[model samples]
Target: LQELPVFAALDLGTNNCRLLVAVPTRHGQFRVIDAFSRIVRLGEGLTASGRLGQAAMDRAVEALKICGDKLRARNIRKARLIATEACRTAANGVEFLDRVEREAGLKLEIIDRQTEARLAVSGCGSLVERDTQGVVLFDIGGGSSEIALIDLTGHRSPRLANHIVSWTSLPVGVVSLAERFGGRTVTREIFAAMVEDVAVRLHAFDGRDRLSHVLASPKFHLLGTSGTVTTLAGVHLDLERYDRRRVDGLWMDRDSVDRMVEKLVGWDFQQRVANPCIGADRADLVLAGCAILEAIRAVWPSERLRVADRGLREGILSELMADDGAWRSRGRQ
Candidate 1:
């Protein structure tokens, strides 16, 4: 019997390190064979220091070592490992990646913001319904938030990313914003300040107005792919525990989103930590994410928002499989 060919994708973000290993399935989507995720807080002090700190680097390295082991264990036909926001902004970003290569035996490429936006759209492609005309997709990362304006008015492209008309990568993410505004002890005033700050940065984007027009149409809606939005969905569902099957592709209207954010704001740090979904790992940072989400909402004001649990990692897997013709090859076999 022929062994199934595997593909792997690793995403090292400011807040989390995630890996996905999969084999192409019949429906063009890949089936996960193995996966891993951990909050490494690689960008914990990056905003203040402008460099990757020793402690943070150590944490990230340890996570990467585990990912490397997973990759080596599989017969990976193609793999793409990437570092985002944290590595892109830190002064010693490349140096840290060098250490990662040496210590983890995995080469990680620091992709630019454009590629980051593209990959995010690609990852959440399936979430966009075929009838949808225009959509605004955003990924709130640890060190940055990427917002892409996708126009599907004319014809739907095979690659959802092809429909992206404009996109922006905000320097502020959950970690950076939290560090700036004090993630813990967030009052309504503090959260508002964070939202205002992000909104100010967003105002400079030339596409905001054009996207705003697209958003006015009922056919358009907001799509969010990030820990922040997923946590919101989980909290809204009041799930005893986090479940991707329930959270991913879940829809939350504007009022529902507002209620969840308000509920979170009312809770103190300990309460947030106590929540099953927003446990100790995300207790401090979840509000920072909410603030960014608020900023996006202020700009787009889409009535309905869809949650996506997948992003860059799925995008990388899809791209690698397509490039390798893995599905087609499987068909022949």
Candidate 2:
């Protein structure tokens, strides 16, 4: 607790390896000191091959090395690193993990699906309304989508009391979807097919009949935390530049989202690549995300969607601070 020790969080996923460093401030707030993200495409070819390619592994290791250096430079006192789906599904995941620990000097924990969804919820929990009835929270990553339905009245936490009523992880993600359907340029047919695929998987979640009852009520909110949602938000804002501060914590109605998706789909690959907020890096995969978002809209039919740029990393940091009593003390100050 002395001098507000800095905490570091590293998230290594199928598509990106990222690191974040932060110092908790008074009033239970924290300020980000540093962050690093590299799209390594670690899960490339995993869907068909059922393995993380050697080339992908090498890319991830290099990224982790850079993250290690950042953590060392900052001399982080408390740090936690985690690896997701691609690591857990790959045959050589353990081997790659060993290499990271020995070569990069970092131990990476492979968490289960439930933990992934829970952490995502924790990261965005601060945005949930305590009295807002049934709200759906989801994170669409490269390898999977984590969904959690919570009843607002169930919240017990000091800041928010939302309780998770039903949660599920869909196996579809941008990478997988792109690999399955197509990522480069999506046709209306391909787009509709992709959304249909996602809708089928969503059937496993808590009884839709029960969820619908809650959704029918007023102030029901849908919270989305992922590159997909954030990208859509950026497009909606029509920013010549992407600004997380402006996109995150913002609200977009169903009509706006639908219109934006239509505009994005109609744009040629070159036009999408030219957009400042999307750029070339995400141009190919944007359609895959649009498909997923459209599917969620069909299922839940919400009027508004809460966009969150925060997720796993924020969730992990919050959990660490809460366990260490740092978050609680910060509030008292």
Candidate achieving the largest TM-score: 1
Q: List pairs with backbone clashes in candidate 2.
A: 155-161, 155-162, 156-161
lDDT of 2 by residue, 204-293 (tens): 666444566678776797899988899989989989899999998999988998889999989888988999988887888889988888
Instruction: Provide backbone clash counts, one per model.
Output: 0, 3
> Candidate 2: minimum summed lDDT over ten consecutive residues — where?
153-162
lDDT leader: 1
Output the worst ten-in-a-row residue range by lDDT, candidate 1. 208-217
- lDDT (C-alpha) at residue 101 in model 2: 96
lDDT of 1 by residue, 1-333 (tens): 778789999999999999999988874587999999999999988899999899999999999999999899877888999999999989999999999999999999999999999999989888999888889999999999999999988877668898999999999999999998998899989988998999999999998766655677778999999999999999999999999999999999999999999999999999999999999999999999998999899888988999999989999988888788887877733
TM-score of each: 0.97, 0.95
Q: Report the number of backbone clashes for model 2.
A: 3
Off by over 4 Å in 1: 330-333
Global lDDT scores for all candidate models: 0.92, 0.84
